[model samples]
Target: MTDRAVAVRTAVFPRDTATVSRLAAAYHSQTESEKVERALTDGDAPLPERYAREIAEPATAFHGRRVVIASVGDDDCGMVVVAATPTGTDVSRLWTTPDARGHGVGAALVTAAIDDAAVPVRLSVWEWREPAIRLYRRLGFEPVASWDDREKMVCLERR
Candidate 1:
């Protein structure tokens, strides 16, 4: 792994949107993509149409959320969207570039989300994302009743 401790900072609007827009877009693309039967090459992914407006207006899109970017040295590697609630902190989004995987980018992002959170920090991830589920479990998140309506979503909480 790299020697750098992943540094995280909350994204500032207008000035920072351009940089994070691409990352946020990638996150949506990856999450919406389907797995192949066999021998299929990963093609250029199309951004999910539903997120078009959000990507277009991040200033208003993340109205109740916190966009925290994770960087190592000078390069931004991952991001997480957190929202505080009366019961707990909800981590609605977490994403890391493929190149940054296995190097603690995801962990850092989640840790940053938890740093200022209330007693319970919650998140909902797709059932297929085993690696992400493992990472959350390692960070003390346990399976909880889903707060999301999406299919195959597994909700978890850290208290």
Candidate 2:
């Protein structure tokens, strides 16, 4: 299919559990790299690896409790997951493969999440993730705080 014809759908279920693991692994790899960079400069270990370890084996099921995976029809274009907490909606993870960048998949997924957010929504990002930061800005999320333990930044939008 042409790029323009490609579209993203929420609630993605992969044909096999292995595919979910691979996608989750890829997601963790990218985010963990950011965490490692923060660790080197900011003096804390990346938490994702530890977090992944504690959650249990078969990480996919644990992840499903808080996040939803979206797909580009058949291709694994990207995935985003959010958790609605008492404070706000936490955009836990959002990623698009390198090949899917600039194709509106990220924005679409975020838009869907924002629409589903409960009252006020909050999301965190590494200060260095300019593309995601930019997308969040475009989607109406504004910086509200900086976190230390997470080594990332937070943004909020109240609907």
Candidate 3:
């Protein structure tokens, strides 16, 4: 008798620290300039140290309460991290490497994150980024708040 193998397509969990680090580095590389940073609507302000504690670390604690979607193909395309909050789901970060733009990966990742959300969703972005703002609007995210000298714009999505 011969043994048989089953073909299954499954999601692979990110495990390598270096891979995560490289993803972070790739994410940062896209934001280091004014054009991209300004597009975040998050003030284009310098990233505070707390952001790393609250956003970057892809650890057990994060995975426990949040859902992360990585739009990877050909390379790491983009990533979205959404954490459950008292009011709703908070989009911690929605980043795409420069190499990943114009590929619809960002939109797909955002959709995945929202679909995975346990509740209503909310996210803050930079106002100067017309493309992102338009994308969020298309996704039903309406403005809820503003911060960072009016550069940061927060949006919400309700059931």
Give per-residue lDDT, candidate 1, residue 9: 92
Can you write out model 3's per-residue Cα lDDT over 1-159, one digit (the tens) per residue?
A: 111221111123455344444555555545545545445434555665544543366554255544344544335445666667776687746766665666676677677778757666877765566777777888878776443354444555545
Using all chains and alpha carbons, the TM-scores for the candidates as numbered come to 0.86, 0.73, 0.66
- Of the two candidates 1 and 2, the one with more favorable TM-score, higher being better, is 1
Please give the ranking of all candidate structures by lDDT, highest first, separated by commas. 1, 2, 3
- For all candidates in order, the CA lDDT equals 0.82, 0.64, 0.56
Please give the lDDT score at residue 153 for candidate 2. 57
RMSD from true fold, candidate 2: 3.8
Rate residue 115 of model 1 by lDDT.
93
Which whole-number lDDT from 0 to 100 does residue 9 have in model 2? 51
TM-score-based ranking, best first? 1, 2, 3
Off by over 4 Å in 1: 1-3, 35-50
Worst window of 10 by summed lDDT in candidate 2: 50-59
Better of 1 and 3 by TM-score: 1
